[model samples]
Structures are given as C-alpha cells and as structure tokens.
Target chain A: MAVEITVKGEVMTALLSGEIDHHSAAGMREKIDSAIDSNMPSLLVLDFGGVSFMDSSGIGLVMGRYRTLQKLGANLHITGASPQIEKVMKLAGMNRLATIN
Target chain B: MKIVNKFNMSLYARSANEGFARSCISAFASQLDPTLEELNDIKTAVSEAVTNCIVHAYKEKLGKIYITAEIIEGGILRIKIRDTGCGIENIELALTPLYTTVGGERAGLGFAVMQSFMDSIKVSSKVGKGTTVTMKKKISPRITVNG
Candidate 1:
C-alpha cells in the first residue's frame, strides 16, 4: 500500500492507494498519525480514490485515526471512496463517526 | 448435478498473502459470473477470514492458511478458509462485533463481515487445534438479450 499526505493550511489530505488489508493498516496508520502529530492539522481528509480493495482493517485504520485526531482537537473526513469501499465503511458504522463523501 | 469446479490452495499465513489468497478465491468464483458487487463481497469475506488466520491464529510466528472454493450445481459457491494455528476458545465472543481480543488493534468485525456477504457461514474450531470457516454464496446467472 502507498499513502501520500498533503498539507493545505490546517487541512491534511492523505491519498491512499493499493489494497488496504491487515498488513498495510499498520504502516498507513503510522504514516497518517505521524503527519497528524507533526502538522497538527485542524482537519484530516482521507482520500480513498485509489484504493481498489478494503476489508475490516480499513475500518480500523479510519477509527484509529479518528481517535488520534480527536485527541488533537482535529476533525476527520473521508473523501473519494469508491462504491465498494464506501459500502464497507458504512457496514462498519464508520459513517457515524466521520464524514464520508 | 455434481461439483462443477473446485480448487484448494495453501499459502503462508502472512499479512501480504491475504490479498493474494482473496484474489485467488475471487477469480475461482468468477466462473459463476457474479456481479461486481457480488465479486467484491466474496473477496472482502475471503480477506477477512485469511486475515484472522494471520493476525490471531499465528500471532508470533508464520503458519499456513488453507483455502478451498467450489461451485456446485445451481451456481452456489462454497468457500472454506482454514488455519492450523491457535484456535478460538470462545466462538461466540469472537463473532461479536467490535469484540476483539487483540487489544485495540482489531475491529472485531471479521466474522460479521463474512456473515453479511455470504448467504450462510459455519465456523468450527477446537482450542489449541485450528479454525475452519466455511461460507457459501449463490451466484445468479447473468441474463443477456438478443440484439
């Protein structure tokens, strides 16, 4: 999996690609967490446009980041999710925690 | 009338192999010509089962994950994902949503996801032995109109 982060003022967007599974979740979490810590962004947007496949691990990745960002007084938003990815997120009830578009 | 097609594969229970195993099963099930949603559902369920083996079964060391896919009559797809590593002591608790034993790392939705995607699921495991997850989904035949 590949994750690229971009900072625009207080909003940090993480563009994720490849399949998001258990193995990739750890690395993606660390990368996003480090970015959140260093930048202290007011809003974090997870871009899932490039992600082809995702399982429950993706839900954990989003939930973990939401918790981390909440601690830093930041908001988490998810964008660019494919229909499949969005369904998984919805199934896991992640929509209740974060804004998905 | 009989089992139309079937395949059995074994791979190292590594996190990286989870995707590979999922693809293999999805491809094998493709013969039934499932829709994109159906295919994605099957793949996601397969990923969850294999992931359980990698994360929970062989926590400290790498082991093996066994997978079997078969298409019987009436376009029913049956998939079995098994691991010979440490099995679950409480299957009921394991099936509970958001009840993970691995302390904050897992979302505890593996079996739930599998259950949602497949038509039926049967889990049998023995503590200190292994776990076998069998899931079945019926694929409907696609229709084509004459031009």
Candidate 2:
C-alpha cells in the first residue's frame, strides 16, 4: 500500500491504500519514521479507509510505530479502517495504545 | 495411501520467512471459489508463525525452519510449521493475550492472528527443543457463473 502524509501543525496524518503486509512494511517504516522524525508531530493519525487488506504485518507495523511514538511521548490515532482491518486493529489491542476512530 | 506424497520443504530460519512461505502456501492451496480474502488469511497465518521462528525463536542465533503441506481427500489443506530453537518458557503464559517476548509494543498478536486466520490451529512446544504449529483450512465448493 502507498502511504501519503499530511502534516498539520503538530499532527501528522498518514493516508494508506492497498494492502499492508510484509511486502509493504519497509515502505511504511520509512515513511512513518521520516514523518515522525521530521515533523515531530504531537500526534500521528493513520487513515486506512483506502486500504483493501491488512494482516499481522499491519499489526506489527502499527506496533512498531506505537513504540516509536511511545518513546517520544506522542499520541497516535487510527481512523477509517475497513471491517477486516478494524478486526485486526482491535485484536492487537490497539485501542489501549492508540485512539481508534 | 498418498499420505507420504505430501510436499515437504525445509528452509533456513533466516530465508524461510521472508514472505516466501506464505506465497508458496497460497500457490498450493486449492482454488475452488477462492478469493483474495482466503488468500490473505492463509498468507497472514503463515507469515505470523514463520515470522515467530525467524524473528523470535532464534533471536540472535541461527537455525532451520521446516514447513510441510498436504491436501487431504476431503478438501482440507493442512500445514505444519516447525522450528528447532528455544521453546517457550510457559506455553500458557506465552499464549496469553498481551504477552510477548518481543515486548516494546509487540502487542502479542501473532498467535491471535494465526488463530483468527486459520480454520483450526494447534501449537505444541517443549522448553528447549522447539515449537510446532498445525493449521488446517477447507476449500469451499465450486461456484458456477453464467452470462
């Protein structure tokens, strides 16, 4: 999936499309890491409305991001996830780590 | 019996999981009314289990991972994933939600994901020997479409 970033003040929004699996993790890591480092956003929002499929690869990616944000004491939110993607997000207990909208 | 005619593959721990196992599994799975959704389930299950061995089981060490697949007579596909590495200290504890050796936001969802994706999942582990996971899924009946 492709990730597009929109930086709004201290909040960075990540718009994702396609599938988020192992194949897509590298790109995600690079994009999210760069956004976090360069923007130093107070919050990171992952928008998954356009994503068609996701699996544990997506979970691992989000968890890695959550860890990075945790270390920085920043907030994270996920929005617009499809039912399948949302099922995975909820299964990963992302609700405890980040806001789900 | 054709039980012995199954597909056997043994791959190095480092190379086995690079998403290759998942791809192979998808290739071998029956295509009766199968969709991208079924393929995703199989891939995700294979990815999580194989990844556990590659990323967590060996940790910093090197080892081998074994994967076997068989298509049964009743349209059931069985996959076995095995690794010879440090086993779980406590199988029950390890399977607990929110518990993971990786820590630091691991979220302990690998097993959960595997369980959710596969029709049936079984795990066996020995303290210092290794862990084995058996997953089974059945192919749906054929669908007919006409103009």
Candidate 3:
C-alpha cells in the first residue's frame, strides 16, 4: 500500500514495499516528501528490496522525487527494482533522469 | 505470505475502471512488500493497457471490465485484465513496438511498457467481443537490495 524509508546518517534509504497504484499515490507522495523535508539528506537512495509490484503511479512517485531533489540540489539513486520494474523505467526514460544503481 | 488464491473483479468498463483496478492492486498485493519502484512499474504498465482499452475499444460506449489475478506456481503473480470492447483489428501491427493508432511521431510505448514490465504477457481478442491482456511477474526468491 505504501513505502517505508530510513535515514542513515547523510544517506536516506527508502525500503519500498507493497503494491503501488493510484490509490496509494497520495500517501506515498506525502510520506516521501516528509522524509525529504525532515531528513534533508545529501544522498537519497531508494532500496527496492521488498517491492513486489509497481505501476504508472510509481512513475509519478519517482518523477516527483527527481524533481523535488532537482530543486533542492540533492543526489538521488535507485536500486533493487525487479526485472519488469527495471524495464518500465528504461522505457519511461528513467535512466536519463536519474542514476539507476 | 503466498498468493493464497486468485482475486477477481468485474465492473462497468468506464474510465473510472482504471482507478478501481489500480486501487485493488495496491490493496491485495501489498503483503508481498513490494518496493516503491516495483509498485510504480505495475501501475504504469496496467494504466497504459487499461487506458488503451477505454480509449480505443469502447470509444465512449459503456462496456465491462473483468480482472483476475493469481499467485501462480513458483510464487509468480499472474493478472488477466479483460474488457468487452472493440478488439484489435491487427494483432501483429498492434503489438509492434512503437506503433499506435493515434498520435504520430510518438514513442508508442504503451504496449511496449506492458510487455517490458510483465515477465509474461499474453493477449486474446476477437472482433466485436473485446480484448484481454495477461500479465505475469515472478518475485525473486531472495529479497535483495532493490527488489
């Protein structure tokens, strides 16, 4: 339904879990935004270790983060996407937007 | 936890059907602990395909949307999304990467995204009957970084 993120020192790590769809977008957007606003980490890392499903609403989440960091001047990185999730990113031009580690 | 069993939903195939189906996914599949990225992938793929049906098939006419999901053998999740709308006239041409019926010079990545995001994708449609999109995903045995 949503994702969880942990801030470790200067690096904020998000442990994204569960299915993401339109319904969950608002909550996710708020949570991630809060994490960014509260932690103000220099490096933001999204760990997809627990993820099981993703959808277009996922794009809005990623893109929203990318834009947010752009304005704040922070480094963003993504990791642990499933193969199917990874392909969607590639097709959506995610590679060009942020580093997919 | 395992799939337990397949879940199914049927509703009037309207634009709202997209949001309804999407909400159901988040509700039913959250237990697997999908990452934010993973959720995004499924959402994008499903949205594109369902949107295609609403846009191309019904052409504003009311129809029906049927969806079935199963945590198949090997811990894989399989989803069958179907609509009673106009069927694809040419499967080959429609499946062609970067091909679309509208908006030229576009990336034409809707179908491409569906195929790319799902481990296995299947489709069935007949003229005047409508179309069905089958999508599958296999969760990794081990939950490593960036699942």
For candidate 3, lDDT tens digit of each residue in A19-71? 55444555777888898999998888877667666555566578778878888
- Candidate 1, which CAPRI tier? high
Using Cα atoms, each model's DockQ against the true complex is 0.83, 0.39, 0.12
What would the per-residue lDDT of candidate 2 be over residues A19-64, giving only the tens digit for each residue?
6765566687798899899998889999998887676778878888
Q: Pick by lDDT: which candidate is best?
A: 1
Candidate 1 chain B weakest lDDT stretch, 10 residues? B97-106
Residue-wise C-alpha lDDT for candidate 2, range B1-147, written one tens digit per residue: 244236878888873255677778878874434566677678778877887887678878888889998877766778999998998778777777666777533457778888877799888998789999899877776667898
Q: How well is each residue in B1-147 modelled by candidate 1, as lDDT tens digits?
A: 579999999999988898889889888988999999999999999999999998899999889998999999999999999999899999998999888989766888999999988999999999889999999999999898899
Candidate 1 residue lDDT tens string, A1-101: 89999999999999999999998889999898889889999999999989999999999999888888889889999999998898888889989999999
CAPRI level of candidate 3? incorrect
Q: Kindly report which residue stretches of model 2 are placed more than 4 angstroms away from their true locations once superposed.
A: A1-4, A15-27, A48-53, A64-75, A79-84, A95-101, B1-5
Output the better candidate (1/2) by DockQ: 1
Q: State how far residue A22 of model 2 sits from its true place (Å).
A: 6.5
Ranking by TM-score: 1, 2, 3
Clashes of 1: 0
